[model samples]
Structures are given as C-alpha cells and as structure tokens.
Target: MSALQALRTVSGKLQKTQIQVSTGLRVATASDNAAYWSIATTMRSDRRAISAANDALGVGAAKVDTAYAAMSSVVEVLSDFKAKLVAAREKGIDLDKIQNELDQLKSQVLSISQSASFNGQNWLNTDVEDIYDPDNNKSSVVGGFTRNADGTVVVNSIDYSMLQSALFNSTGGGMLQADPRDLKTIGGLRFDYGNGLMSTYSLRNTGGWGPTDFNFDFSSPITFGAGDSISFDVTADQDNPADGITPPYDAGQTTSIVIDAARVNSALGRTDGTIGTYKEYAAVLRSALVGSGLTATTYTRFEPPGQTQTWVDVPDVVGIVHNGLASKDGSSMAISNVSFNGVTQANQIAPRAVAYGTRNSEMTLDFEPFTVYADVVVSMRLRVDGSYSNLSFDKDFADLALGKDNGKVETSAEMATLLTALVNRPDVIAQASGSGTVSLKTDPLVDRKSGEKSMIGIDGISVNIEPVPTMNFLDVDVARNPEMIDGYINYIETAMGRVVSGAAALGSLQSRIELQSNFAKHAMDMIDKGVGRLVDADMEEASARLNALQTQQQLALQGLQIANSQPQPLLSLFQ
Candidate 1:
C-alpha cells in the first residue's frame, strides 16, 4: 500500500480506538455514543424492582380476600343459629328440650372454634404479652381471632384481668379464677377413658401452693355410661375430714390450686382448648354463679348493686374472691337482716358467721338462662395471673380451665386474664393462622370451629362434626318456662350484637387501611421509577444507536478503501 494510504488507515484506527475508550464502549453514539446503552440499563433494572413489589402486594391482597370469603360462611352459620333460636322460642315445649338445643348449639360453636384456623393461625386464639408500662400502673391484654380453611372459628382472646371478673364475679364481674378447692375436690368429675390420671391440688398456705396431693377414692376412670350407671358417694377425705379446705393462705397457708392435662388432641382437625364448648357450658358457669342467685366478685363492691348478699352468702362462687376483696365486709347480714322466702331468721353457718345458713344445703340459684343465638360477640384466649392473693383454691380454676379447652388459650380475654392465675403472669398462647395457610379470607377473624353457630350469636363457629355435614345441628324443646338455656343465648345475642356492631367499625378501619396500603404502594412505585429514570437504560435509544453504529462502521470501511487507493497509486509510481 502507499505511505499516504497506510498513514490514513493508521490514523482512522487510532481515532476509532480513542472514541471507544473515551465513551468506555466499543460502540457509542451510532458508533461511539454510549448514552443510549446506559439509559437502557437503567430502565430495565427499575422495571424489575417494580414488578417484584407489585407481585408482593398482589399476593397479600389475594390472601386477605380469601379470608374475607371464608368469613362470609361464618356469618351465614351465625344467621342459622339465630333462626333456630327464634323458632325454638316459638315452638315453646319443654325447658329441658330448649336446654338440649342450647347444648347442641354450644357444641357447634366449639366445633367451629377448633376448625377455624387459617394456615395454622387461629384468630380466636389470642396471644399474651408481658406489658411493662413505665408510666401509670397499667397492664394490658389484647388479642383476636381470624378465619380458617375448612370451617368457622371462635377466636380465643388473651386478656386475663378482664376475663377473670367476667367469668367468676360474685361482686365485680368479668373473667374469674376458679376455686382451687374445687379442683382438689370436684363434686362431679366423671371421665370415661382412663389413663388412670386423677390430679389433686391443695392450697392450705397463705399464698399460692402446688401439688397438695389431695386423696381421690374414685374407682378408676369410670367407663360406665347410661344404663351401666355407678353411684359413688363424694366426701372430703378419711384423713382431713371436712377441714374446710385448709386456710386460704400460702404453702402452710395456701388457699387455692389448679390441675389439668398438659395438651389437647383430637382425631378431628379441631384445635380444642381448655374450656370445651364454652358457648353451651358458659351458662353452667353463669348459672353456678349468677343464675343461682350467687353474686361473685365479678363486679367491684362500690361499682353497682348487690355486693353484699351474693358475695357474703357464697364467699366464693366459681372460685372467685366474692364478698369483699380481703378484709372489708360488705354484708348487711351482721345486722340479722338475712331472709329466705320472706323469713328473716337467724341463718347461722357452721363454725362461722350466721347468714342465710338454712339455705346452705340447697341453694336457690336464679336463672337468666344460657342463651347462644346463631351469632357470637367475640373469640378469645385465657391467661393465668401469677399474682394470687392465696393458693387455697388455685387448683380448681386451673383444672377447669385446662381440662375444658386443653390450654389452647381461652377465647375471651377479659374473662381469662381476670380469672386464671398462679404466679402473677400472662401465660397465654398467641393465636395466628397457620403461618402461610389462608382462612375465611379474613386475616384476623373468628368463626365456629364446626361451621355451626348459636341461635343468637354472630361470631361463633364449629367444625366438630366430620364430613362437612349439613348445618342442621342442635334441636330445641321450648315448652318450659325460664328457658333452661335462656341466659346463654341471651348473653350470646347481646354480646354478638355488640361484636357485630364493633366489627362494622373495624370494617371502616379496614377501608382506611386499604387506602393507606394503596397509597404506600403508589408512593413506593413513584420513588422506584425516579430511581430507575436516574439509572435505567432507554432500550429504544440503544437500538437506534446500534443500527446507526453498524451503518457508520460500513462507511468507515469504504472510506478506508478509498484512502488505500491513494497508496496504490504511489505503488504504481514506484513500479
């Protein structure tokens, strides 16, 4: 080639390399412009992140929707329960029959509670926390229930203090602590299957006690049912006699105690807790306390009414600290002002004060009735309070709580916290849906475990019966007066209505949440877009440059060829 041609070729090569290096790219600006490539890169990265965020939000929303759908079913079941109650009231037959219906309805409620868990988390089952508030003397108990996969559920809330007074208050009502003496000395305890397990606790000390080893002459776990019935006489003991449940003190002076199975297991997919069928049986508790004209320590003394009679007559009903909390005597009985059937006579209690003594053996318990309409008010869990004034009756409350629900956390927060306690604590389990499983479309909702609801309640559910059977559960015989199960249904109806009303409020809040969530997502998207715009590549610009670069390369080659022709002329001259 000619020297001039070679020089041009070398110069062109140098220019190309310099362009490539300066642009930090082999191809930039059609040939050396690298701006488009950089733009494209930035856009793609930003888009990917946005896509990921969208996916996450989408999944979350879908799960929430699923829960909502499930809750719809729960609502339906509750409606049925209410319908049944109305029908029963109209049928009006035997009070016993009505009781039976309530019993059945309660079972359904339990069934739903056990079965209503989403992804394994049970909203009805609430969790407990140790709240150490630095400010005022404030203790807290908060929790909730949610939907499940197969059936409805009764969420177990974990609010101890509130629950205690509610459950066992002869005076101040709320949740209540059971009588430890009752645990050690049960009036009627009959278990069929016998692993030969009989627990007994004593509280003779001045404070909380344990494993007092109360004697049990029970003839094994009597597997006998109706027809093959066995009549066994119940008494204090051969050794202690009617020692009056030794001082309500500590170890040497303990007052209460509790005992029950460590766990609850069922072949059915039910997460049964300590209080079995609380809906049906809650009346038994209420009847034992309230229905029986027994005033418990549920309500505070100076709060409202009748803190004297019920409290003093039954020093402790359902294991509550009735009468006065400690030393204060709120009873007007000291003035010989006690009466029965309008007979103001001196009723003397043995070895103690005389107040409604004659009515001791056979007490007259009032009946508000055990009512559970097809609805529910709330689902919650119970927690034990460590701060026991005494342990004389600790075992009773613990035993009842554990034996019934199997310690799955009580479904009523105020009731559980207000009552159950051993040391001064909140030994409550947290209820959440199975980490990833979806329930009635609700994130934190409650339904019956068996899909069955009460006659008057709204938030109850039960999946106890298998095969997802028909919703036709319990029957009611409504011929008798005072409706044997009136209180339960009534309470449920009242409670549920409130719950539903409250839920409506929550729904409003939920709408707000949705709005906020959307806003957050939009804001996040905008931020991401801005970031991407800053760094993402513009593909269209890049593509255009690539095409232009190809054309330029071709032109450069042609120019070089022409430049080489000059060298050829030089060569010819040389020739």
Candidate 2:
C-alpha cells in the first residue's frame, strides 16, 4: 500500500511537469497559484493595451507629418509671393505680370492646404464658420497610454490648436486672411505755447476754436461783381506799453486797401474787371497787399492747401480760414475797422483787429509707439498767414507718401517723414526730436532788430481714429490697385511667419509622437518581461523535472508489483 501511494504521487508530479512544459506557464490557472495567476493575467492585458496605443500613435504621427509637409510648402509659397510684391514696387515693372505670378502662388497655397490630409483629417484647411470657436478649433493626437497605481488605465493624447495651423478657412478668420497688426492712433495734435499751457482740440467737431479776432467763411467761391468792394485798416510798427522794450511811443503807420474788381483787374494787368478762377482771385488779393505798402517778403506769405503748393487752387481750404501773419522786423501789424460795400453776409469775409506777435501758434505732437490694433486717421486744418490748409493722414495717404510695407507711422521720425511728404510744402517744416515729439511750424522769420526767430502758426488741428480693413493675401490685386502693394507685402510677410510657426509646431508634435511610440514599445517589452517572471515557466527546468518524475514513477511501479507478489504469499500462509 505504501508503494502504491508513492506511485500515485510520482504520476501526479509527472503530469504537472508535462502541463508546465506544454503551456510555458508556471501558474496557468487560479488553482495552480491564485495570487500569481491573477497578477500575470492583469499584466498581460496591460501589455495588449500598450500595443494598441502604440499603433494609434503611428496614425497620429502620420497626420502630423502630413500637416507639417503642407505647412512647409505654404511657407515657401508665401515667401515667393512676398518677393513678387517687393519686385512690383519698382518704378517701371509690369505689375500685371507680377500679379499673375502672385495669383498662381496663392492658388498653390490653397491647393497644398486642401490636399494635405491623412485619413480624412486636415489641419491646414478648415471649414468651420468661426475658426475662433474654442471647442471646435482644437485637435488632438494619441500620444501615450498610462496605468495608474490605483489600477485605472488611461489613454493620453497630444493637443494642438487648429487656429494656429489653419491657412485657409471658408469663413474669414484664417491666419492668411486676417489682419495681424491692430490699427491704432498713436499721436494727436496739441497746441504747445512754449509756456506751461497746452491744449488739445477735437478733430471731428469744429466748435473747439478758442478766442479769435476774425472768422472768415470761405467754404464756397466768392463772386466779385462789378462795383463790389471790401476795405480793412492795416497798422504797422505800432508801439505798445506792455512790449517790455523801451519805447518813445512812435506812432505806427496805418494804411487801407480796397479789394474790388477794378483793383483785382489792375493787379492782374488786365482791364477785363473779372477774375476767372479762385486761384486768380487769391493772387489778386496777395498783389493788393504788396501794392498797399506791406512788404511782399514779410506780410504776403500765406499757407496753401496741404495737397498743393499754393493756396488758390484747393477747394477744401476754402472753409473757415484763420489768420496767423507775423512781422519779421519786430514791427507789429493789425487789421481792423473793416467796411464792406455790396458784399453779402453769405461771403462771411468779416474782418476784426488782431494783435500779431503776441502768441505763437505752432503745435507739437507727442507720439507713442504703435501697439494697438486699429486704423488711425489724423485730420488737421492748419492756418498760416490768414489761410487754411487741410491735411489728413490715413492708410492710403501713408502708403502713397511713405511706401512702407505696413503703411503706418510707427515712430515719431516716420510720422515726420510722412507728414513732410504729405504736406509737400516748402514753408511747412515738420521735425521730430527727443523720443517722439514732433514740432510742426512754418519756416522761421528772423527779426531784424532783436534777432528773434518767429514761426507762423499751425492752428485748427484735429485727429480722427478708425479701424483698418482686413487685408487677405489671396485678395492681393496689385494690377488693379497698384497703390496697395505695400499693404500686400506686409500682409504676406505676416502670413508667412504664421505658417512657419505652424510648421514648427507640427514638427515638434511629430518628434513627440515618435518618442511616445518608442516608449510604448519599450513599455510593452517591460510588461512582457514582468508577466513572464510571474507566470512563464523555464523550459529547461520543466523538462528536467518531467524526466526525474518519470524515472520515479517507473521505480515506484516496479516496487508496487514486487510488494503485491509478497502480499499474495503472506495471505496463502495465513490460510
């Protein structure tokens, strides 16, 4: 019975060794080793999940690669487009041909963006109505898989903003189609009296004019008919007790000048008694001043329209003229005691006494750096020597005058240059110094006695602010609007920067995905090794055990047979 029991134990041991060798697991079921079996099973499932995540990472990497390729192409195309725009700025180039090339480049950009897709996923081209929609304008790619200590499994992904990568969208918010820099008004006009007092006037409304001696409404043409005349008294070298200079009270000379058709015709060297144009009328008035003993070099200087070199030809300067004449020889002048015959009030040519040389009318503008996003419009109406000159600075004017890529005055020096170009008048001098302060004044007149320099006034100035319209790279038509080439170049340069940035983002994502894929593969291997340690059987050990158990089984069987024979003999003896 002992031999039989030993034979049964050896048989069971051999069967277990055979199962271990066949299945290659030390704990194949819960009955073998419940703790090890459970742990190994869980590890094997985690390895499978990691393998699946690695596969997903491959797909995500491919999508990122496609987007990167497309973005790189777009960057190249935009560079070429900007080069063409720069070439178009040349004086005699054929803008139409350049525009055709630009069109082709723009079309290529669209083609690349639309065609760059992987598995129906496109990052450069989008169709959402608003690209700024937070929820819809983002994309994610599977990056990694994680199993927490608490036994919870989670899948991780890499996220990217579609807004940054989108080059073309059916809606209007694409990077290439939107405005990069915001329109901003940097500086405005203000009266600086060289004293501590300064004042700013509204640009939109004309009611801000402070105390004035005379207000003339020349908004329309004046018809000087026969026998019509206007007269005003002019005084020179007037003595004042408040002038701070020793004075013997020398009586200044006063003269009256009559402006009529007879005088105008006499000034024009014609007997027709008629002035054909407004320019001719202005010339007649200037000549009358010179003929009335006021020196042409000192008193006849007047401000012209900002757009022209002379005051007589511009219509916009005809409204609400202001006077700012000064003497160059320390002699004061005044116009007063006005009388008009046959001149209606509709002409608004009323005259009043004004003490010249008492105050300076020059203005200074302090400009801040342009850092906002909006269009800026500066409207100014300056009065010099009793005349009006209207000037406005907008994108159109800036482009025409400066021909800069951004079409904006970014610095005080740039503003001065733009103003100088826009005014185009020799008498008006605009200068920038000490950071961003722009001093606008007429050419200085030297005082013959005291050697004091006197600058005529630049008054009635205002500024207007407005937003610049969005300029799209695709809509660049230099052939039709040749003036907009600067703006086009600016927009294209900004768009190219955005495309390059998006491409860089994609490249970074590609590298991350590759790293994650490698990590997933390594993690899977490590998990396999761990599970193998828990449940995988050593083949050599299992085979050796099987052989040993078989040998023991044979020995026990033989011993059991011998014992049985002996038992039979003992039983016979007992009978």
Candidate 3:
C-alpha cells in the first residue's frame, strides 16, 4: 500500500478505538446504531413508567389499609355494644349503665372512622361522590405499565370500592349511626275511656220492651179487706228521653203510663173473694194496659152524675176506676223497687191490705210505661247524677240500624244488636286497614343504605335512640317493666351484624389492594431489570473492552508512525 493511504487508515482506526474506550458504550447515539439505541431509549422510558405505577400502588394500599383498620375498629365497637345489650337483657341488670357503655362504643366507632386516614386520604370518614352509582367510587391504584402497539402508553390498575360500602357511607346509614324509631302495632282496638272505669254487663237475660214472660213470685198470699188500696206511679218525659250526653240507649223518645190501685183491684179482679191470686191479677193488669188508650200528658180528672169519669190529658193509661174503698193488695209484698241502666229507683212502693197478710207472699206488677208494644215501645231513660241524661243520636250514633231508623225499636234481636254496637263503639277511637289494630306514622329516614323511605317500625319492635312524640324504649321505665331489657339485646345484635358486614367488605378490599401492590412491585422490578438488560452498561465487560481498545489505539498509532517513517526513507532515496 502507498504510505499516504496506510497512514490515513491507521489514523481512522486509532480515533475509533479512543472513542470506544472513553465512552464505555456499544451504541451511544442513534448515529452509532439506530435500531438498538431507539429500542433501549423506549425500554428505559417504560421502566420509569413502571416505577411511577408502583408508587401509586403503594399509596392506594396505604389508603385501603387505613379503611380496613377503621372498619375493624367499628366491628369491635359493635361487638362490645352487643355484649352490653346482652348484659342488659339479664334479669335485674342495670340497663342505664349498659346503655351508656353502648353509647360510648358507638362514639368510638365514629372516632375511628374520622381518625383513620393516611397521607391526607380518608376513605372511611368521607362519603363517595357518586351517590346514584355506588360502584362509581373507584379508588384504584395503577398495577401495571405497558406500551400499546399504537405507541400509546397503557397503565393497568386494580379497583377498590371499599368506601362505597354500607358501613363507611356517612350520607347513608353507617355502622356507627342509627335512626329514630317510633311505635307501631298490628290488630288491636284502641279506646281512650278517658278517666272512667270500664265495665261489662250481660244483658241477654233482660226483656226488650214489654213484660217479657215475667211472672210475680208470692212469698206468701195475702187476704185483703174491703177498705184498702195500694198505689204507684210511673212517669216518662215526653220532652226529653235519654239525657243527650252519653251512649247506649241515648237517643230515644218514650212514653210512661201509671197503674193505679183502683184500676188494679176493681177493674182487673183478684179472682178470690179475699184477693189471694196475685199473679193472675198482675197478668190481667198488664194485658189491659197494652191495648188501652189514654192521654200522654198529665191533667185533672172530672166526674158527672150517673156518667163515666174522664181524664182530659192524664199520663196515658187504660183503666179509670178512681175509688179508694174498692182497692186492695192481693200480694203481701211490702216493698218493690225498680232499677234501670245501673241505677236504682228513687222510691219504693208498699202493698196495702186490711186483712192479715203473710210476710213472704210476693207478686210482680208490670207497668205500662216500661212495657212492650207492637210498633212503638217505651225505652228506659238513663240518668246521670240527679237529673236525666240524653244523647243526640243523629250526632253520636253512626253506622247503626237503630240510629238510622230513629229509635223505633222493632225486634228484641235488633235491640240487642244495637246495644252491642253501642257498647263496642267506645273502643274504637280511630280506624285503619290492617290486621287487628295498626297505628301508622311517617317515614323515619328519607334516604339510607338501600333506598329512600325507610320505615321505622320494620318488625314488631321499634328502636328509639332519640326522644320523639311516640312511645319507645328510651321512655320506658325499665324498673317498672323489667322484661324490656330483652328487646334491647335483640336490637344490639342486629346492629352488630351490620358492622360485621362492613368490616368483611373492608377486609376484602384490603386484600385486593395488597395483592395488586405486591404484583406491581414485582412487575416493576422485572421491568427495571429488562430495561437494564436493554441499555445498562456492564462494568466488567466494559473495562475489559476499554483495555483492549487502549492497546489497539497504541498499535494503530505505532503503525501510523511506521507509515510516516517510510515516507521519510522515500525522501532519502529521492536525495
């Protein structure tokens, strides 16, 4: 080779070796090797992305751990609360003290939720933003890093919706929170008797309106003389019947007729010459008054010579014999009293006889005013205090045949039914549609875990934590009714179940985050190693190459020197 070409070749080889030895790299720039340099740069970028994803995963794991811890604390608090409730259920336990402990445990749960935060992120304490879709509360952490075929960077993440769970949701019903409850019942008749005593009487034995198959009992028969008479009067208020105030037989307008002694002994005969047969006399008197016609009002009586005596408007009666000498008492009864509507008669009437009378002889005389009729019958007047009490049937009695028909008592059965209805009316203060008796109130909670309009009375029991206008356990005097402690135990157990479910959800989410974090760490390490393989310089290999390149540079320089010396020899030849 020519000296100039040999020197130029050696100089180029020495420059290349010096550059390789100083730089300690196979491909330093794209100009050195386009394909390898581009691939190494891209892989290094991917490794950095993996590191960032791992950092995000760590942060997410911390948040999940914090939530998990808070949930665990809540579960413990609920457990303690349940224990207190169970203790309260024990016979003769201090319920107030147990309730205090339960309250404290609930406070602890709230405290834990508020304090459970890591790196300025509190999952348990805060509520999810998306209320409509609870699952939209995505608290995911990046788990993987990758490059798409289209040159887009793809990051894979692990999903965690722990905060959206029912336990931690504050806007909804959380584990630590509770709603106010009111009393509700099914199937019962509610009556406010005010301040009166409630009493029931069996009235099936009593007659409807007439002298129902009733007879007189003679303790002993009496022998009457020619100049003795027994008299009694029954008066009815045509202006006012039942005192228009109370119930039962309140809305009735009735008439009263009196049976005098002259009509009983003279008109209706005693059968025996000495008036021994009293029952037959009483029957004859009752029959005569039922068909007889007389005035309904009171007036004076006048008599004309050899003519019949006339009463203008005397208390409607049948017989009109007004002679005291012809009247006689057949039965030897001294006193006879009347009673109606749980009240006794004001006065008693005694029988009179001129002859010797046995003390035990008794007879029943039916009065016309208290007797029965085919169409219109006289009703018993109810008295309150000294005066007669009345009721306005149009305003008081409702949905009854007697009230609708305007007190025209027809049959005995109809009258009995009306009585029953009136007696039961006091028990029904209000009406609703349910089994037995049910009282309903408004919704306790508007929105909660499941949905809106959560009712207070779910089961037969009501849980009350606040003072409301209704009855509740808080207002219950446990000392008076010791059986109420058992109910609180059941409530606490139900609350514990809710807290446990929340804790379980938290644990599951925590596991997911931890697993994703572990995978992210492992994958990031692998990616770093791969990037190192693609671009990282091997120190031992580079050192060996550096020594060899240094020797090669020295040899190339010697060769260039040899080539320049040859040019010097050629100059001697030219001399």
The candidate scoring highest on TM-score is 2
How would you order the candidates by lDDT, starting with the best? 2, 3, 1
By summed lDDT, the worst window of 10 consecutive residues in model 3 runs over 199-208
- Residue 492 in candidate 1 has what lDDT? 42
TM match of model 3 to true structure: 0.44
Instruction: Please say which candidate is ahead in TM-score: 1 or 2.
Output: 2
Better of 1 and 3 by lDDT: 3
Error of 3 at 37 (Å): 2.2
**Which stretches of candidate 3 lie above 4 Å from their native place?**
1-24, 129-132, 163-170, 178-487, 532-549, 566-575
Backbone clashes in candidate 1 total 221
lDDT of 2 by residue, 216-314 (tens): 334454445777887777665454434344545544567777788788777777776665544555566566666332332111222653554544323
In the range 328-408, model 1's lDDT, one tens digit per residue, is 111111111222221111221112121211101111111111111111111222112112122222223444544532222
**Distance from true position, residue 230, model 3, in Å?**
57
Estimate candidate 1's alpha-carbon lDDT, on a 0 to 1 scale.
0.30
Candidate topping lDDT? 2
TM per candidate comes to 0.32, 0.54, 0.44
